[model samples]
Target: MAPLSIQAPDDGTVLGQLPTDDAASIDAKVKAAARAMAGWVDAGPMRRAEVLLQIAADTKAALPELAEKLSKEQGKTRKEALMELDRYIGPFIQYAGLATAVGGRHHQLGGGVAGHVERGPVGVTAAIVPWNFPASLFGSKLAPALAAGCGFLIKPAETTPLITLRLAEIAQVHLPEGLLDVVIGGPDVGELLVEHPGVARVAFTGSTAVGRRIAARAGQGLKRVSLELGGCDPFVLLAGADTGAAARALMGTRFYNAGQVCVAPKRLIVQDAVADEMIDLLTTRINRVVPGPSLAPESTMGPLHTERGRAVLEEQIADAVDAGAELVGGGRPDGERTGRGWFVRPALLLDPPQGARVRTEETFGPVLSVVRVRDEDEAIAVANETPYGLGASVWSADRQRAWDVARRIPAGYTWINALGRVYDELPFGGVRASGMGREHGVEALESYLEDRTFIYPAASH
Candidate 1:
């Protein structure tokens, strides 16, 4: 098979190449994991915790080198890349602390019977991570699986496999041989992992469409699966809210990572009373974004991870404009920098028609689609109109009012006067078409485990 080329989206530089994994290679890894499962589980949680902590320490020591590689391969500014590495480092420590806490309950029943409900690892687990935040998302799955005493296999995104492969390499030093493995390739490799009988559970983070396909295949085999899929999160502003503050928050949340974030505020629903002020503030801020190479010091935002992503974003903007939305602030940045990369100036579309694709679809780039509604009722209604139910935010000076509005929205996660601050302690996931299952917090750790009830008769006393 031909090797896959990893290129820098900022300058089309060939960063490196990796040989794609075939079914045989993936199967060998899965068999190895299955073979090593018992020893890893028998090592107990404390030993696993020690291994995780060591890996985290090693990862921290190599942060600069890893961040640079991430910036080049994933197309985010160096600062953003470092921040992503920080996000990665956190989950290992979080799960490591939670390791020994995984336990069961004992129950005494009548007739001299005693029952024990125990939780145990769910055998070999496969994690299929996306390109947008590879290292962070990988850690979210990897740390939890190991802490739960499960053998792990990973299929990193083809475009951004270097950092994940390197992290796995770093981890393997502290991990039992064949206990952790990475298979590098496109969707075919992922399909092989999902369908392999040796894989007991599959955790995926990607589009809802692909997630559904994975869910179906896993279901046929009666295997456990968790999916963190697409999202078109809403950010709503109420009448008395501070438009300036809201706009400032939106600039970071909406354009971070060039807006490839799955839970970023893709739609802005503002009450008519403050819609104009909010639009004006957001437009002013969007125009100031400096689009250039990821490693360049002056560049505030990097290119989209792929040319296809940039083109799709452009089409979404065009569709919104054709539907009569006002293109308030951004478009293709005009400069010498524009010709060499997949850069797109962050965009703001004001009052896009209700039926515009930007309103209905997940625009996975730096484009914000705004909608104006007459009242909070209309705002909540508009916020819940999308097929996605990943996340939404309500902004208001009145805490009670913001809390009420947040509850009225159907998303799995909602914020009050906040945009994109995801806490490690909170469980995060989506409802409806945004996909099912949760990541982060204890819920993630539990997903890699299974429960068994052991009931035995007590000896006569």
Candidate 2:
């Protein structure tokens, strides 16, 4: 069979081809991973940590090359790609030190008996990553799985597998063979991995619709599934907040990764007192964001990964406009640039109708809907109206007031007076339809492990 072709999103240039995998090949890889799991268990904690550290070093050494490939294939700016590459260090280092943390616990019973809980690998684990933020998301799964003494298989998205394959190539040398595997294909390949009997756990990051399917399939096997799904996150500004700072912060969230981020601020719910001032400031920031090729340093934003993605954004914007939403700026392509890439202008819709598509659906583009609310109560009500509970940010002059507002918002992660920053030490995931299990931190590594309890009678000794 012919390999799948990967094209650069910037200019539709052919980057390379990756061989597709079938069920038979996937079975062989799973068996290989199962075999490698034994050796990994025997390697001990220090050795495992050492291997993770070495992988981190190798990745650091290859940052320049990896970032370039990521930018070319993933449709992110070169600067953003480099930032993703640099951020990989945090997970690798943190996981390396956390090797000692994934251990067993002991408890004494009252009747001369003791209970012991031992943590062990859940067998071969599959990590199905999405195209957006591939490298960073890979580390979120890979580092922790390695620390937990499990074999890891990566099934990267078809459009953006080059950088991940390159990382696998660099990593396999330092670790045991079969400890890390990379398979590139579309949804079929993912189906095989999720339904494979040998795979004990599935770590997935993508749309909620696909995540529901994967979770259902994994559940039939009684397998563990960790999902980082979609987000319709909200950004709120209270009456007393600094309009300038809050506007700039919220603007950055929508423009980051061209607003393709799962946790990007999708809805802007502002108090009526400062809504007009905030809109003016936000529009000023939005006007300065220039969309161009990902490789261009001056381009503040880049194109979406595919033409289909752009069309989806266009449709939603059109629907919102038709529903009486005001298109403020940058709805059409810039006249100065040639029409070659899948590009959309930065758009701000002021006072969109309640049923506007932009307000209801996850736009996943450089578009934002600004809605004014009567008070804090109305702001919270509007923020929680969406089905997604992934992430949100609340801005207020008083820290206590912001914290109070953040608590009322139903999201897995909420930032008070901040935006677009996630730490490796903190847990990252969502509630409701956003995702199933958590990723990052100690909880992430333990998610790939299963615990067994043993009770022994003292009389036997």
TM-score of each: 0.98, 0.97
For model 2, the stretches where C-alpha displacement exceeds 4 angstroms are: 335-338, 459-461
For each of the candidates, give the backbone clash count. 0, 0
lDDT of 1 by residue, 65-166 (tens): 998999999999999999999989898999999999999998888789988899999989999999999999999899999999889999999999999999
Candidate 2 global TM-score: 0.97
Error of model 1, residue 186, in angstroms: 1.0
In model 2, the clashing pairs are: none
Residue-level lDDT for 403 in candidate 2: 92
Candidate 2's error at 21, in angstroms?
Answer: 0.8
**Candidate that scores best on TM-score:** 1
For model 1, what is the C-alpha lDDT against the true structure?
0.90
Evaluate all candidate structures by whole-model CA lDDT and list the values in order: 0.90, 0.87
Q: What's the C-alpha lDDT at position 53 in model 1? A: 96
